[model samples]
Target chain A: MKKKKKRLSLMRKRMFAGYLFILPWLVGFLVFYIRSIFQTVQFSFSEMSMDAINGGYTLTPIGWENFRYAFLEHGSFKQTLTSSVMNMLVDVPLITFFSLFMAMILNKKFPGRAIVRAIFFLPVILASGAVVDAIAMGEMMMQGGVSGQMQEMEASASSAIAFDIDYLISMFMNLGLPAKLLDYITSAVGRINDIISMSGVQIVLFIAALQSIPSSLYEVAKIEGATGYETFWKITFPMVMPHIITNVVYTIVDSFEQSEILKLADTTTFDMWNYGLGSVFSLVSTIVTCIILVVVVGFIQKRTFYYN
Target chain B: MSMKKGRIKKAFQDPYQRMLLGNDIKKFALTILQIAIIVGVCYVILSPVIGMVVNSISGDKDAYNPMVFIFPQYPTLERYKLVMLRMDYWPTITKNVLYVLTLTLIQVLVCSMVGYGFARFEFPFKKLLFGLVVVMIVIPTYTIKLPLYVTFRNFDPLSIITAIKGGPINLMGTPWPMYIMSLLGCGVRSGLYIYIFNQFFRGLPKEIEEAAFVDGAGMWYTYFNIMLKNASPAVITVTVFSLVWQFNDSFFSNLFLVSPDIVISKKISTLASVIANEDKILNVTLQELYLHAGIILVLLPIILIYLLLQRYFIEGVERSGIVG
Candidate 1:
């Protein structure tokens, strides 16, 4: 009875220590996260303009005016939001699947695997906003450089390549593929390079998950005379389900945040000084992304089998 | 029938030929397919980087030449010189290096503490608090950008300072926003790091901590000396991740580090405009070669760091304890 009481006290002490450690995060959550969320919602419904006299923002209450403008008056706003959603839907699955496939292949013992893995992971380093912006600027300047005549030659050369691409695309179209399907396929083919770059983190995460699965499970399956296909479904697939959820959640957030159309909203708000309208744009996109995340993650969570 | 019999006899005579008839042939085909994909993807990821390098060194005359794509015909340091002069690389890089290192160090220490707290101990509302951390990871920064900006602009927390000063204290145009956020466990990808650390700590055997508890060591002593010493893998993982993220991060820095020349990213961002203005004044024609060279130069440090720390970084990724 005395020992039990001591154990209970020890537990209480440990709990106290836990709160002490997390105190900073708790304070931050209140000060930064929750407060910021409320402010965003409030600012979206208000008119905020900078006062030149004191370099301060003057806010006038305007009920849903920004949101009304975004939904009804702002033509490009709705279009951009829809296109961003569509892009996320398409990009997420492709990225997740491709990363998993690559991770599985790279997990095997093979010649030059280390180099291949490094190549796959290189994008995580280069995907920084600075590098990406620099590359974008460089490409723009390269095309818009002093040699207009040279650009003309390059354009013609690209057009020649385009003709061959069109020919190959037509071959698929000849098989009675839908026009939309053909377009998506052609675009995806063009962006195959981008897909590889974007999958670096996901591939790394999946490879880590794959490596953590005990080999004993596989050995057991083999002893049971399970084929490779069966072992994958019964063992590897189930084992990696939690990682799948993690990857899916990651991919969803990443795609929505970095979508091309959403970047338009960024330029519109910050660059064009339409802070109210921009807030509405961001809030709407964020809400949609959250809805998708809750649905997908909840669904995957139900299926995930936890070992511990 | 006679020809079939002859073929069977030949197959029996040559075991190597016979091996190709069924599963062996399928395995061979699968191996070829796997290699093709690995090589193809590598090429796709590599070509742009290679293109960047090759074009950065090509002379203006060669860069304009239609025939020069992968190879530089007349390699010269002219573009590099122009880029170096335009970017003011040395001072800008040094400043950014200092900022990244300092910020990264703070984040690594603070985030590890938070993660350890969540992972190793139990407390009231622990589940709810950790859920908030997960939400922090999920919610896009844009949703909170305005409020965060406002909060930083005022530079007051919990309204205590506001009550004292009777006005907003502006922290804009200073590094305080980054320092505060990082210290508070709300910096860039802090949630992810905390999550990684939490997973790692959970995976560690409980016996080690139990042993420490029995040895009459205080929690701080155990955590600082024993627990941390045993957690070298997680430390390396978190450090590399924090350093890289902080270095690459421009979103928060762009908002707070409003000084155009304080950070490398900020400088790179304004490079085009700076050059355009230079063109208007200096009468020197600016072209894409300088821009390409500048981009390569910006990426050079990161590339070097990654290559140097490849072993530790890869090990971190492989053994981060983020398993199902």
Candidate 2:
């Protein structure tokens, strides 16, 4: 009885230490994240106006007007939101699978592996902020002037290649593959650049997952005389299941960050100076993303195999 | 020739030898396929970057020339010179680097502490707290951008500033908002960083901490001396990630209206128009060349850092305990 009491006291002490350690984050989360989120919801239900007489702005309660404006009245909000969500739905799985495939390849030993890995991760830097913006601007400028000629030149250059995508499609059709599957494949191929650029971090996560799998498991499969294909299904696939969830979550969040809806929100808030409507845009997107995230993560969590 | 053919036929008839040859062929074929896929994907990734590099170097004559596709006929450093001068490249980059580095450092420290706490101890509301962390990751920054802006603009947390200074103090234009957020473990992507560290710490064996406790090392001592040393892999991953993200971050910088000198990326969006107006470079295509040059300049420092750290970064991720 005395020993149990002593152990309980120790547990309490450890819990105290835990809270102490997390104190800063707790304060920051409540003060910044929660408060801001609350304010955003509040702003979505109110009208914000500048107080020229006073120093700051004021929010007058206006009910569902802002949300009604967004859903029913706004021209591009619904279209942009649906398109962005559709893009995420398509991009997330493609990125996850492609990253997993690339990770498996990169995990193997090869000459110039380090250099190839560096090149693959280049998008983590380049696709983020200023560089991508500048590149887009430059492309837009070029399109107006020189890109027409450049596209023609590219057409000729690509025509010199012996293998044609059209020929491949025809061959696949001759083989009687489903047209729906073929359409998906062709679209994925078209978005190959976006897939490659977005999958860098996911690839890293998967490589780490693959690395952490115990070699003993493979040895056990080898002793059982399993083939490479069997080993992958029985061992490698299950071992990396947990990371698939992580990568999916990451990919979804990343896709949302790059989505058109967020850009629309930015323009609405800062450029158009429509704070209430801007809050409505962002809040709706966040809620939708959160729902998708919860449903998907929960589904994956149910199936994820935690080896350790 | 007949004797050699008989010998070869006999060798092929051996099951072990046949299997070995088949395996070798399979391996070789797979290697060839892997190389093709990797090279093709790399080209898809690098083509635009390569285009930018070519455009940045091409002179006015090459810009207009239809035949100049991949290579420039009249390559020059003029665009780089002009962009560098106009962007005030050196001073701006210096300030941005310092700001990003400071934020990265604070994020690493604060996040690891929080992550360690979540990983190691049995605390009440741990589940709720961790759920909040996930919420942080899932919630769009745009959802909170305006309120966060207002919060910092007023700068009266708990009305302490009001009580002390008689009213609110504006932190909009200063670096304090970012500093405070980072210091308190709520900086850009801090939730993800904390999650990573938590995953890493959970993967570490409990015996290490037990041993430290047995030796009379307190929690903080054990954490600082033993666990943090063993967490080098996580540290390297976090450091590289934080550095890169913070360096490229425009969301917070723009929301706070941080001075252009302190956030060089903010300058990049307006660089073309600035050049068009100031240098009288009215031609859009030429302005684009200068913009590309400016982008390359911005990318050069981060690229150099990435190259320098690439070896360790890759190795660190391989060893990092973010398996989940």
Candidate 3:
């Protein structure tokens, strides 16, 4: 009885220490995150106006008017939301597949692999916030004068060397592929830049997953006379299944960050100064994202193989 | 020559040798195809950056000349000099770098602590708390931007400031909001950093902790002296990520209205307008050349850091156990 009591005290002590370790984050989470989320929810249901008297804004409780405005009255909210969701649906699978494929290739022994890997991760730096904005600004400015003509010439030259998408579409049409599948493929090709830029972190995650898969498994497969394709199917794919889910979630979140809806919300609040409507926009998107995330992650989690 | 030809014929005639030769040829072809694909993708990724570099160097004559496509007939450093001066590049970059580095350090420390707590502890509501971390990651910053901005703008915590100072403090246009957020482990992508550290810590054997306990080291001592040192992979991963994200971050900076002089990324956006107003060089195309130079200037420090840490960063990611 005494020994059990001592053990209980020890457990309690350890738990206390754990809480101590997490105290800073817990405080921040409660103070910053939870309060912000709560206020945002409250804002979505209220009208906010500048309080000239007290200097801070006042939130007057109004029912679902903001949400109604967002859903029914707002011109671009619905379109942006749907398009962003659709983009996510299209992007997630493509990014997952492309990153995994790249990761597999990158994991192999090759000369200048370090350089290639570094080059692949370049987007994580360059395609991020202000750099991309600045580059786009430059590109927009370049589109008016001599550079525009130069760009046209360069595009034609590249398309001549590269297989034209139009030619490929015609060839595939003659070969009688499904129109929907062809549309998907064409869209994927069109957004190839977006896909490559977004897949940097996903590729890193997949590479980590690939590297963590024990070489012993592959040796055993080889010993059993399995071919490369067989070995990949039997060992590699299932082993990396868990990371596919992580990458999918990551890609979805990333896409939403870059989505038009978030930008619309930003404009609504900061530019338009419609705080209630902006809150509604963000809240609806967040809830939709949560639903999609739960559904997709739940689906993937079912099939995810946990090796240990 | 006759003997060599006979040997080749003999090898070709053997079924095993023929199959081996065929497999080798297939492997070689696959390798060539893979290289082509990699090279193509790399070119696509790099082309825009190359374009920016080329444009930044192009002289006024080259900017207007239709013949200068990828390369400039006459390259000049004049645009860079003007941009550097107008953008206040040196002072702004130094301030931004300091801000980013400090934030990165705080994020690593606080996140690793929180992650270690989640990873090693058997506390009440542990699962629920960790779920909040996941929620933190999932919830877009836009969702909370308005409230967060208001909260910081007023800067009152539980009526403490309100009671003492008779009103709330406005933290907008200052670095305090970012510092406070980071110190409290709520900075940009802090959830992801915590998750990485948690995953890494959980992967470590429990034996280490037990041994430390047996050696009479307290939890804090063991954590600071032992576990953290052993978590270099997670540290490096978190450090690089935090640095890059914080450096490129416009969301939080914009939300808090952080001064353009403090966040150099914010300065890039206004560079063109600033140049136009200050220099009276109102030509959009000419102003664009300066903007490209400014972009290159912003990218230079980050690219340099990435190059220096690329090896360790890649290795860190591989071993950080972020896959789970």
Candidate 4:
């Protein structure tokens, strides 16, 4: 009983220590982050548009109204969301597989590996707003920012179908299916190009997780006459299951929080001020993301996670 | 003090760390893959940048093909000069460097202390508070811009340098906000940094502290000698992370001090913002110069720091909670 009491006291003391240590972060976060999130939701509900003067909505609240605007008034909401998801569909998997692959490869021993690693991770260093802005400016000069040249390119390409050249592909076009699908796919790809550029950290995380796997398992597998593919299946895949869940959740959360793109388009539509709508959008996205995360993480726990 | 000579020797003898860090066939393939992936990744990341540079440099009057990746057949430095004259690059850059340094240092120290406390001590409300930290991990900092902007709008930059704007006390459009942010360890990636420190410090051997306590040493003494010494890995890691994250964190600085009142250099405008705002940087004739200059200016500090801290940064990343 005395030993039990001592153990209990020690546990209590350790727990208290942990709490005290993390206090500053907690206070700062509540003061800064939480209230802002609350405010953002509030701001979303109110009508806002960027103007020559301070760009914002003249704050007002209209319940479930912004949803209507997003869904009913502008079809672009669904389009952009779909486009974002589609981009993610391509971007996330490509990033994950490639990063994981790179991570695995990097985990190997080789000469000049440090230099290579630095180069690979250099993007994380370069992904600053400064770089982004510089790149954006550079694009403006070459692409003419938002000039009609791009539109002209699309127009010219579309017009290509009108010429004698049309005869060769006329049968394919008349089926009407391929043209529409191709056009839609191109447009969708163009829409979410911005989000695809920001997967540097995801790559790093995949690499780190890959490194955590023990080599003894591989050696054991080698002794067992296991092939590389088999080792990946039986060892690597199971070892990094937690990272998969983490990446999925992180990607979803990031996709939602970076609503800056939408917030821009919102400026033009529904001139009414509504913070509630903005908040609602954030809340809805976050909720959806969280739900997806919980389910996925839960499933992962059951199917893959093993107690040590 | 019980120095782990045995452990140190064993660590030196440890084949795994040496094997991992040292060169071998596995490392060679990884190095190649890294180079390839880096090239691909860099191209994507640099494409828009190359585009921006092209846009800024092109001699075209009404419209330059910014996305033009082909080297500008006519590269010019006129835009660089224009941005310099227009943006007040020297003063602005000085201010930026100073601001980043002040903010990073304070934040590092505070975060280290707080992280140390969390990792080593037994205190109250530990789990709940730690949970709050975890929750803050996902909590976006941008959400607080409005209120904090309001709160700090009246405050002043703290006592730092004489040449800086906003006096020794201006918060509105001053370095003070970023500086204060560091003290709280709440900058761009400070949350993660704190978490890193926590994890690193937690891994520390408790025997050192316990022995210190047995000797009637105070908390500060134990912390400085035992915990801090043992926490070289964490410090190195946190410092590098802080440097890099603070260097690149354009979002918060842009949002906070983005007003016109800010002097050209001390402000948080980075290459990304300059590129984003290329049209306004200088007139068309000097666009090319601005492009190259912007890249140099924005990247120079971080690049230099990165080079200097390369080994340490890698060390930190490795010592960190996760990933190499």
TM-score of each: 0.80, 0.88, 0.87, 0.64
Cα-based RMSD of the predictions, in order? Answer: 5.4, 3.7, 3.8, 11.3
Give the TM-score (vs. native) of candidate 4.
Answer: 0.64
| TM-score of chain B taken alone, candidate 4 | 0.65
What is the fnat of model 3 with respect to the true interface contacts?
0.54
Q: At residue A26, give the lDDT of candidate 1.
A: 81
lDDT by residue (tens digit), candidate 3, A180-236: 999899778867877899999888767666665656677788899999899988888
Model 2: CA > 4 A from native: A48-58, A65-83, A143-165, A213-226, A267-274, B1-11, B154-169, B203-217, B225-233, B273-280, B314-324
lDDT score of residue A225 within candidate 4? 100
Q: Give the alpha carbon lDDT tens digit for every residue of B1-324 in model 1.
A: 998778768877888757655566699999999999988788767766676676668776675466665667788888788668888888878777777778888887887788889989988888778878877886667667767887888776667887999877988888879989999999988887787666556645577777888989888787778666555555655666677778778888877754545566666766666776875422222355666677778767765665565566445433334321
CAPRI docking class of candidate 3? acceptable
Ranking the candidates on TM-score from highest down gives 2, 3, 1, 4
Candidate 1 C-alpha error for residue B52, in Å: 1.5
lDDT of each: 0.74, 0.82, 0.83, 0.57
Output the number of the TM-score-best candidate. 2
Compare the candidates by DockQ and give the number of the best one. 2
For model 1, the DockQ equals 0.42
TM-score of 2: 0.88
How do the residues B26-119 of candidate 3 rate in per-residue lDDT, one tens digit apiece? 9999999999999989988887778778888998888777778787888899989998898888998999899898898899999999999998
The residue-level lDDT of candidate 1 at A175 comes to: 95
lDDT of 4 at A1: 97
- Candidate 2 colliding pairs: none
